[model samples]
Target: MLSAVAGAVRFVMVAIMTVVTFITPFLGKKEGKIERKAEECKAAFAAISDTHLTDSFIRLGMFEFGLQDMAEATDRLDALVINGDITDHGYPEHWQAFTDTLLKYDISDNNIMVLGNHDTWGGDRTGDYTKENFIKYSKEATGREIDNVYFTAEINGYPVIVLGSQSDHTGPTFYQDQLDWFAEEMEKASEKGLPIFVFCHQPFNGTHGLPYNWEMEKDADPTEGGIGEHSDYILNICNQYKNVIFISGHVHAGLSNTEDGTNYSSVEKVGNVTSVNLPSYEYFDVLRHGHMVNGTGFVFEVYDGEILLRARNFATGTWLENYDVTIEIEK
Candidate 1:
């Protein structure tokens, strides 16, 4: 009788653990499959930023629009580009949710998402954060080997570079490294007449030739004087290569507007290459993230070498701007 009781207890415990492991993380994702029976194709693709998801919620505001974006993209786009913040924090529930999501979606694992503010930094105990762990989670979840190997991928025929903020350094110094690396890459692109697009976590500069700051100062550049010492090298590099496009989130303003030749407005500099900023869909507290009104990301459609942006209109499903200008790749 004693042996039987012990056996039964052990069996129950094993079953409970198994169920918890498998059954959880079935949240945050709607059931769907890629539109194409085989696969989809397109010339270049749309840039997707700030997914900000993990598993638990049944439904949310941007769910349908995101799905629609995927469907449209799969139908017309050859690949997808994500600008980072893949996990909210690396909680068990969020990680599990993220793992099961890719497994279920049957989505392509070639997506490029950057590590953003939402992801925890080193020594961040509660968030389960750290680039190594984040890399591990992504590799395990998506079944893809990540490194400089996958950073530069060719979608369709165009080349896409996805930059990360959590490498060697997560602070302002990264900007300097990013500038050097970007300049080398841009040199090659310029020689080949190829255009490079940058998707980062923070904006390069604030609107009106200032930085998006923490204190709302008179003359602050988020890239320079906001939190950490701003990276002076980044703007210098971009000034030389104004043709390069920079798109980002964490500012919640539409595309940035700056006279410092850093922020490229779609309206002001529509023809010449421009830089853009995106809005955070999840958190939008005025005097905090935004004024609670305008808070959405910018999406870009690249054709030939011309990149066009779609403003923030989640309701109409016209998220990223459509391609308008024609690109001439001089061979």
Candidate 2:
């Protein structure tokens, strides 16, 4: 009973905070702008994660700011990748809000939706029901027919592959079949000799300060805050390829500079793959280690043989220049 009461109070607080955030633009909050250097790139995309949209208009309004900023930034986004955790509880109402928001913004017709654990968490329905809803809405967003949660797309001639867990869990679980598919897809994507963009909701087990980064628990298991048993298997597949850029979310760890001597930065290179863990697009009080500024994500620009990642806080319309990184795509 106490826990239920605490949850109720927390919800009320969050609702109030959402309202305040929603109206910040009208209250003299200086909106940051993203300057897309279009002439300097071959392909570019905006990647964000953990929107966690619910049925509330205020929360949806908060999300709308990001989309609005992106639309205003570029004439046309080559693609927009929402890495995962799209809905708060995987309920119909939650998804309806997301669909409505997408319709309101003419941001990108090439919107790519990836599955997060929360998107499969059906509050009162079975997991399969929620997964089906994901497929339905994903088609609505991307205009592509997809039967499975994981799929691939070619955006501006660049290979973009999205991965998802077969089951709903805090940490993702990958079955053998999905693992096999991923390997095959990687092989095909690698043949182009261009930077392959991969999106997953959860990071690998130890990258980006996992376990400690997930819950701030010093003694947690290595896999506590990442992809579960198949973590190494996925890493191995990435290692086999050159110029693979892996992006993920779920930890909600904020942006940090590499000089911080912590693995919690927004970007890291594991083997042949460049790993990027995005900050949660919405604010949650559970974040630790500072840098929890909400509305944070990255814009990836592919050059001849290098990929430049620029960090931005879309909510306030600001650029996080300190977290910007440039990675050389291995030839």
Best by TM-score: 2
The TM-score of candidate 1 is 0.63
All candidates' lDDT scores?
Answer: 0.46, 0.80
User: What would the TM-scores of all predictions be?
Assistant: 0.63, 0.90
lDDT, residue 166, model 2 = 76
Q: lDDT by residue for model 1 over 1-331, one digit each (tens)?
A: 9999999987976565344323322322433322322322234444544556666352222333443545444444454455555556545455556555544433344555555665553345322245556567666665546653115555554555555554423332354555567667656655644565656665554432335443367555355421134433554554565456655555433333333233433223323435554554443323332223222344444555344454433323433323123333322
Local error of candidate 1 at 226, Å?
6.5
- The CA-based lDDT of model 1 is what? 0.46
lDDT of 2 by residue, 1-331 (tens): 9999999999987776576566544543544455566587887788989998898776688788888888887446788899999888888788878988887777766889999999888764455676688888887766778888888898788998889877778877677778999999999998898888889999988888888877678988888888878888999998898888899999877776556545457788888788999888876433454455677788888888788898877766677677889998776
Q: What are the runs in model 2 whose C-alpha is more than 4 Å off? A: 1-32, 123-127, 260-263, 284-290
lDDT winner? 2
